[model samples]
Target: MSATEYARAVAFGHAFARRQAVRTVDVPGGFAVLDDEFDQVHDLNRLIGTGPVTAGELIAAADTVFGTAGLAYRQLTMDGPTGTELVAGLTDAGYRADRELLMAYHGGELPEGVPVSVVEPATLLDPAERAWRAEAPGLADGTYRQLARQRLRRPAELTRRLAVLGADGTPRAWCELYLSPDDRVAQIEDLLTLPAYRGHGYGSALVAAGVAQARTAGCDLTFLRVEADDGPVGLYRRLGFEPLGEARQFHRAAGGT
Candidate 1:
């Protein structure tokens, strides 16, 4: 069958990971992304896809690769499951899966009536503090901060960061827009807003700014991926983004759980 838009977009994501991963090794169906520097950043330290291999072999390889690095866990990212056997096998093996939805912008107006500007990724730290506390209340203040910092550390030579700043000059909302090497695809990632600032229209404003930037770059496809049942799905739909695909990520947090 011909590849769906979602499949093409998934390929684009894997290509990006391969292009920037500090180290990569061929695995059964695809490869593993290994960046010890961001070991805790699961996306930077997980398997990128799956193929026609037995679940036991896949789990063993993943454990070895990650375990050898002292990461203590195995994680896998793949487009939605194709067969029940593998999915059932992995589930029985104790790997938990989470669904992530990908949506594509279908050309339209967005409520950017608010001001959103391109900003240094470093500048968002102030606004991100609230996120650290709200999202991971049990984590050490430093750990949450560290996680946020690590995300910004990703390869960004092809990215533009956008933010909506309050009158006091602190970011109320922010997101990252990444244009593909050929400028044909743009993926809006890491959209965030502080807990106390939720209703200020910052999210839509930031998205609008990102879409504008994508159009300016002549990117033919603009998309955003978020966890299923996430709050922003409705907002994205209202802004003209339609479902393109979904990814199912299997995670076994440190020590086979």
Candidate 2:
């Protein structure tokens, strides 16, 4: 990763945690984000940051935090050398690992398809269930719903909740655009479109809307994060996004997946 890309990723993650976590506790390497009320919402409750610490020490610190908070699972994502090096140790200790990519706009702009409007996260729930479950069929119904609903906990004004609604007023596609122009970055997160409605290009339209809006807001760069192997990477590339860097995620499910 270039220093610029790496720094952007780290800065966004740190800023996001500080603003969203119910409570953040200091620990070796970085900090533990705790939010018992969210029922293990990984983004709101996980270990973040990377300095230097053994996998054993990292796991111990994370477990202590979750245990004290009565959380049933644990998640940690580190986008640095310390995290990259801990992959083997974490997997050996039975944690599931995921590789994620940080991408930035390079040039592909989609043709305008649909108009998107600001809306509450809940407004997209019906279509989201159809879209997300098809993309991540492995997650249980309740888990997927909970994951999507996690955004609702935040103040509605935090991010621009953009969506393309169906004829009946339900959103057919949705996403969140968080503009932090002072940081010179605008993050477009969690893009989803209903399964049956996808071929019509709702996904690309959402991306276009976000990119145009973010740039209009004076953000120097627009970025998105997703698992390295996710299918949407192709679509995003078609819309001008290219790989910036990588991040590693180590997680243990409630019953230890």
Candidate 3:
């Protein structure tokens, strides 16, 4: 795919993430309280709103539940580089910037003849689950277990779908697709490739699978964020994903009193 097309696909991925985040909110605690609906490529963080003080307070509260309890976490969204205070707040706490991504999309001919199958967690393989677990370092063990529980119990609240391509057996790589409440978009929740499987077009194939799922769900767009400094920016660039915006994160670890 050309750079333009790649960028567009990535943007679609981001939109999907945003919409899924908005839809999957559980209210009172889960997603609704955080109000991550507006998060975009330029502003990846999802924690913002009402008053500045309220926003900070909300972050602190989230720290207790999402952070400490490990049931969830926060992703703050800013238009560009964060302010000194924000940086200090995050650093003093424990949180630091994670994925700085170039967001882009337009939509057209995807990589030719990429095979895709969208399967739910129930239909997926344990190896695929392990691959995603290995990729998300920030995800706590409790949270990971809870995800499995939610999928088994409250399947609606958790949409765990995967995209696979390449050789029929053993598979190549897979991507997770999250379906939100509104059903407007599908979040490419997470993408994973076994260490040995990297660089073999598996990632792009996963991206294609996500797009197909999102469109099938009646969603118009999809989305995700990448580290601005990550070398793969070129890969995303070549794929058509462009820089749409930026976000900053702050965290305080247990050491902070």
Candidate 4:
């Protein structure tokens, strides 16, 4: 697929991730998901799309939704002209921009001998919750449980979750793959290796399993997004993934309730 199409596919996958949230709304050029229960930027508030909406209009729309939700911060994905103007407008409005690389991997053979397994999204919840809590004990509260529950309800054919298990059958690493309906593109998302399992090839194994599943499902291209400073570029490259472009996220800190 061409670069622009690839980027859009990745964006679609992200929007699809929050399908269970009740507050997503369509705006002038795109859509937004607004919530007050979760601290995650994407979960609490997010604007998606890259159409030709004015900065003023975009800000006004975001303010309406975020204000009503009593949320001060909103994250936006930068894409087309509308994205550019929103970034400038949001900056002037006291928001900060964070950039990340969007990467893609065309289908190919995965490495051998790396054990990976595909599990139901529901099956991932218990172990994932435990792992997450182990890493961030402070966040092991009701809100986190609620978010985890929401994530377990996968959006129909559009998404799939894969995992690599430890000897005891606990998830060591996992990732989600989203396939476009036409089967032309897929996106690998939320790839994570538990802190205790990092560097044991579980991450690589999970990724390979995701790609293989996408290919078997008839997708020719796959994509993912990674933080600019998280430092996994080399790992993805070694797995035959390459940079397509960057997606910028703009965040506005929470304000008055």
Candidate 5:
């Protein structure tokens, strides 16, 4: 795909993630999402879209909204125009910036290997909830397990949650396949394997499963995002995901709240 088309596809995935938030509010040039249930900035808080707004104005708007919501940290997703202005603005405001690559899968045959089973979000709920409760506390503060329960209960129609189970039927790894409402594009999200099972083929199996499902659902394109420094970028590339573009995020930790 052309650069323009790739960018648009990534934008669609961003919009999808934003819409799934627990709450959203309009800001100056975009929206602020609140999802305190999950620990990640992409899940918990987001500032999207800046359009033609000045950097100062955008920061002021973020301060107002996040301050009112009592949230200390937030991630601002930067596009071409807004990114240039916000990098300077955020630097002056004492925030840090991180870059992540948005990747896309060109249509073709999927690699074959370990089989992945498609499961209802609810089927994995019990173990997933348990895993979150056991794992989230050490990872971050706040009610992660509670939020995870809420997330599992609120699966969107466009989203397909799949998993690989162990001998005892415990979930070993899982991923989500999200098809755009227009059905022209899809995204493979949250492809994760438990730490104990990292070296196994579960992650690759999950990706293959999601990609196959996306094609079956009539989506011609698929996409995902990875941190620039993350090791999984190599795995994704081996699975046919190519780097299309990059987005930067500016964040301030929650001390202000």
Candidate 6:
């Protein structure tokens, strides 16, 4: 498998553990179980733990679970060479498909800030700072306070801090540096900038700040993801991050539209 593919798999496995607070167990026969409230079996490149062996078996079992709980499940994709039979099985079974991109960085020192001081994200949750983050383009979906509260409710099992680009009382950008329990690695999450503030270098500064913070926290490496077609790929590459892996994202709505 390619390095990119390998990195992507590791990233997903890392994120999956965070999102579900579960562990990926190494079962027999080159397979593993992502044991959440609903256990899923998959191989390296990712196939549902349908039967004991393949996607087909897993889907057959999934029907009952999804029906009974009204739960929507998705195929757990992995990285590297997976058998075509598994893809065919999922397609034949009507599983939805989508794609995601992964990136990683190593071997570079984060540039030191000359004018601005890198501070902890928790500081920004203060009322005025929260207002600034809420108005920030990337965080427009919700308030910074709301998101912080939601995150704090969880066991900080591997939660990253929310860092913002600020001078005086205003924030120019925002990003999160978090940890993954399964891999014990730090990762960049929720990197965002206000659309109007894009050209000033705040994005780079924010990422650098995140990396520096993670390193200070004793993390060995950092990871982040971006859309394959997005322009940030170039920016990230320039910052020493490279393609690590690829993934598929599947989503379905209540209305099924």
Per-prediction TM-score to the true structure, in the order listed: 0.91, 0.89, 0.60, 0.83, 0.84, 0.60
Model 1 TM:
0.91
TM-score of 2: 0.89
Clashes of 2: 2
Give lDDT per model, in order: 0.78, 0.78, 0.50, 0.71, 0.72, 0.52
Residue-level lDDT of model 6, residues 1-257, one tens digit each, is: 34744554465554554454333333222223233333221211132231234655545544443334344443354343345675666666666555556777765655555233444545445633454565554743334445443433223555555544455645556665666434546777666666666777777877787676667777666777677664488888888887766654332222322
Ten contiguous residues minimizing lDDT sum, candidate 1: 1-10
Q: What TM-score would you give candidate 6 relative to the actual structure?
A: 0.60
| Candidate 5 wrongly placed segments (more than 4 Å) | 35-44, 81-85, 107-109, 123-141, 153-155
At residue 172, candidate 3 shows an lDDT of 57
- Which RMSD values do the candidates have, in order? 2.2, 2.5, 7.5, 3.1, 3.1, 7.0
Candidate 1 off by > 4 Å:
1-4, 181-183
**lDDT for each residue of candidate 2 in 134-163, tens digit (9 for 90 to 100):** 767887767777776777765444588899
Candidates 3 and 5 compared by lDDT, better number: 5
Q: Model 1, range 10-73, lDDT digits (tens) per residue?
A: 8778888887688998988778988777777777888877456667777877877887878877
- Candidate closer to the true structure by lDDT (higher is better), 1 or 5: 1
Name the TM-score of candidate 4: 0.83
Residue pairs in steric clash, candidate 6?
A: 4-244, 8-244, 8-245, 50-57, 50-58, 51-57, 51-58, 160-177, 160-178
Cα distance off (Å), candidate 2, residue 165: 1.1
Distance from true position, residue 197, model 1, in Å?
A: 1.2
- Cα lDDT, model 6, residue 142: 39
Candidate 3 segments whose C-alpha is farther than 4 A from its true place: 1-81, 123-125, 132-160, 165-171, 179-184
For candidate 3, give the lDDT: 0.50
Clashing pairs in 5: 72-254
